[model samples]
Target: MNALSIRSIHGRQIFDSRGMPTVEAEIVLHNGVRASASVPSGASTGRFEACELRDNLAEYHGKGVSSAVNHINTPIQEALVGESCDDQWTLDNKLMVLDGTQNKSKIGANAILAVSLACAKAAAKAYGLELFRYLGGLQANTLPIPMMNILNGGAHAGNNLEIQEFMIVPVGAHSFTEAMKMGTEIYASLRNCLKKKGLSTGIGDEGGYAPDLNGDEEALSLLMEAIQLAGYQPNYDVKIALDAAANEWYKNGHYIFPKLQKKITQSELKGYWEELCQKYPIYSIEDPFAEEDFPGFSELTASLGGSVQIVGDDLFVTNPDRLRQGISSLSGNAVLIKPNQIGTLTETLSTIRLAKEHGYGVILSHRSGETEDTTIADLSVAVNAGQIKTGAPARSERVCKYNRLLKIESLISGSEYPKK
Candidate 1:
């Protein structure tokens, strides 16, 4: 048996859904198998996440990724040309050490992630195994329940709502297919309900309708109505989640709700979440507090962690060290997993392993600014993350992930959490 070495690595600047440029890398093994992956951009990115390098020149409104593309072809290329393709950890570590930055800014986390994901694809292709199998071992077969973003507000769209994402979780569905079907149905019903009420059905970035709402409660109430109208029971057949993206609205030790024309202190925010959990079928709340307020996170978790999933995205940035700290402090019960947050699959996997070890749930996520990349679909299944936060079933970029999951389900065995 001969070891397959990396033959060549190259990258190019491509456009994402927002028409902004991003980096895409292609890796070819000596055996002629080639794989490519593209990095997605985030509109409401965390400060602690790895730096997404951009060419801040006069071109493309400084959104150009030409510099990152260059990093792939030169520095990244030189580092991995003769490396073995199967040892993903070794190849990824080489990139990390080469950059020598905590945030992977030297080569751009975008460039590093593109190469990292592309390398994983190349290995999976060489082994003739599914990408999820390559990453999750034999036990990686379950499709994640979709946390479909149906009402986009805050940073995801040009709306007056403060909540970042209002999601629908088909908790009662037995299989991934059923859950997805329920989501699509509820989505259509919501659009119809909006149209009947003479409300704007225009969508936000994540394909959720972005009508000007009075406040977050309005969003929740409408979703509940839509669930019953769609012939599903709320809190039983389906549930709700919120990605407050609190970092977007947090300022000066207060959560500024511009729509409500008020500010919420940490205690107020915690009380508000508790009230919502009790009133509605809310199952999860993400970034419910400011990013740096670890104690606030801990307080929210301590109060509502048993009843709901208090997930930390901006709080931990998917960094293992930060997650470890959160565990010690009892900040959150689940961690949102975004590969670009840490810049490599190895690190992303490490975070998932650590979170699982600490009894924390994992939710694989996608950014608001996305492309037609289905890598995250495979990733969710590979890690059996159990939940995925992709946008609604509207845009081609968003639907590509759902379509990929449907295909994966066609190949794998039956579901573990079959519809009850």
Candidate 2:
């Protein structure tokens, strides 16, 4: 038997950061090497994202993953137990073929993704290489600049603000460690500012503060003040990024802000974004339009693509086909790569490659519902993704990634931090 051949496969249900059940898969190689991976869930998922199967039973409020866990422990394990885990593409394709579904709804993307990532982790161990080095090869030495989300709204928080995430980008940091220091200071400063205003300093799902601000403008203003309070120069030392998640508020062919009692057309929304970009040190705007509004994305990209990174999260969902469409239509200047969004590491890497081939910036991101899995942290470095949108410096689920990256920085020699 090949030493790299899978000897046993196991699956179990695990609770994520959101207290929701998710699939976790463990792969044991014949050589006695073993690794396990867990899948994360998203609260505000895109319509086009791969299916995350769940039991509709009353258990766990219909967020149970028993069905997905069963698929992994049974049929998926049966097919992959004797297979070699040396080649990620082959193993991942076997999973895709076994399910034989377009969107992985049959076996659940959660199950397939867990097993797929576990296989990769086991293979990396068998080769005696770190996960990042194993996946990215020797040239993968560029550490990504972290886009730490410090404030939350929309579906992610109970705040009145319309934006989903307000992130701080440490643009002037010389290294990944410095970036984390900047992020930590800014995060603390933001908490102080919120408390000073007598606002709720409660944290959201992704570890960002959920304050009831007046609107998006106030949210931006608070972020700016926080940066300044942290002794960072806005736009020079640090910049702002927004995940509008516009799909959350897009209604009846118009965008609505209930807190502001405002409703505006796509064209008007574009003008508003334009004005905000001009007034603020905004470096990136993600999901600026609804997922289905490819035209709106293209128009905004054309208007601000040169100076600002108009990223597509829901518009692409890490699907290469959607990214190809965006590329052809000139929809956005960047793509947010989420492994679960595509159900496999190969597909995720392919999407990153595709984005780079077309000159689009790549950002490895975390789901709103996360686990202590630091796979994305290594992945961000492996691919030199240049940017990562893991949440703030709070919460173990979010901080695990940052901690892993910090360790990697200490271990790897000659690792360069990518220019922000």
Candidate 3:
């Protein structure tokens, strides 16, 4: 097959739940195949809202978005204008060379993510397989791993800040439908459990009260509660995890540091988390502290590493040098992986391998600003990363990935991929 041609490029708003402009890119291949990808705006109007990296990217959005549009439409487009769509990697690398030094910029990275996703999606369509199947292969299919969320249980919105979010997924369901049914049942049960404890519906932004209702903890809680009510145990077949987003913890000198420190003690903090683990069976915690607090993270990891995984999101930023430092210093035992963090899929995967080599569990995650594209789901399975943390299972943008996984499960009934 000759190189594939790119026909068109455009951007569209996909998610606006939190009021930010998160957008997705649509790219059409020469063969009339359409593919898309989203870049979450990392900007934050509030402390507890979505990841701020997108906001950082926002500063460069115009340039980044334009460059990405051109990257897929320019050199690569020319190289593959009339060629077959096979050999995507070679064409992708050729495009990389055209990008040259500009690739180092955030805009460059955005361009790469958009282009790579479009290419991958095109390839998946060509094979008549789900993107994950193309990326992870049939042999790697396992039970649909369980998932939970952390939306409340923090100091935000008058909540305790003592409890973290979590979810439980059954591992051996026969099909996606069965797994979803189990998830739904678990969510219902959890709702009842919370109601028995006098908790409200826990549906809206005000229901679960984390320090930042708009924060990662709140999102995580919502997901966890949803999973629990569906009739699954948190952290059992359904692995429990949090997306702290580095908001609860702050830099030592941040203006609010003193006030934040006074609200929760180290021992009290440990006790709170310990109790959460005891009651909910949590398996992972991400960005438990401020990004700069490597010592604090190391302490937390060393203290709880035996029973639970400590993950780094802001801590690593998808930089290998930082990851090396993290592993060497024992700052944390896991890393949240995001392609846009470092710009290229290859670079992102390299970080995953490095984390794995160091015994760190890798979690493929989504930004608060997300799109319909679900490439990360496939990336997680392809790399054999243990988990994926998007958001509450309620949102279409978030659940779309889960639903797609279910579709894939339907096609290959007996694959090893986790069922529930």
Of 1 and 3, the candidate ahead on TM-score is: 1
The TM-scores, one per candidate, come to: 0.98, 0.99, 0.74
Show where candidate 3 strays beyond 4 Å.
Answer: 1-3, 7-19, 42-108, 127-129, 153-179, 192-240, 254-280, 417-420
Q: What are the RMSDs of all candidates, in order? A: 1.4, 0.9, 5.6
Model 2, span 62-138: residue lDDT tens: 98999999999899999998899988998999999999999999999999999999999999999999999999999
C-alpha local distance difference test of each model: 0.90, 0.93, 0.58
Better structure of 2 and 3 per TM-score: 2
- Candidate 3 per-residue lDDT over residues 1-420, each given as its tens digit: 332455555554344444454445566766667777765544212231222223335544432344444444555456545544445566456545655653344235555566556667776776676766776676556533545342444332244443334434355455556656675565566556555656554542212223333333444455566565665555554656554444544444441323234455454555655666676556677776666667778888888888787888777877677789899889988887877766556567678889989888777876555666678777766776746666556666667777766665566656554322
Model 1: per-residue Cα lDDT over 237-341, one tens digit each:
999999998887787767888666687777888898899998998889999987888898899888888889999999888899999999999998999998989
Q: Residue 411 error for model 3, in Å?
A: 2.2
lDDT sort, best first:
2, 1, 3
Better lDDT candidate (1, 3):
1
Model 1, residue 398: C-alpha shift (Å): 1.2
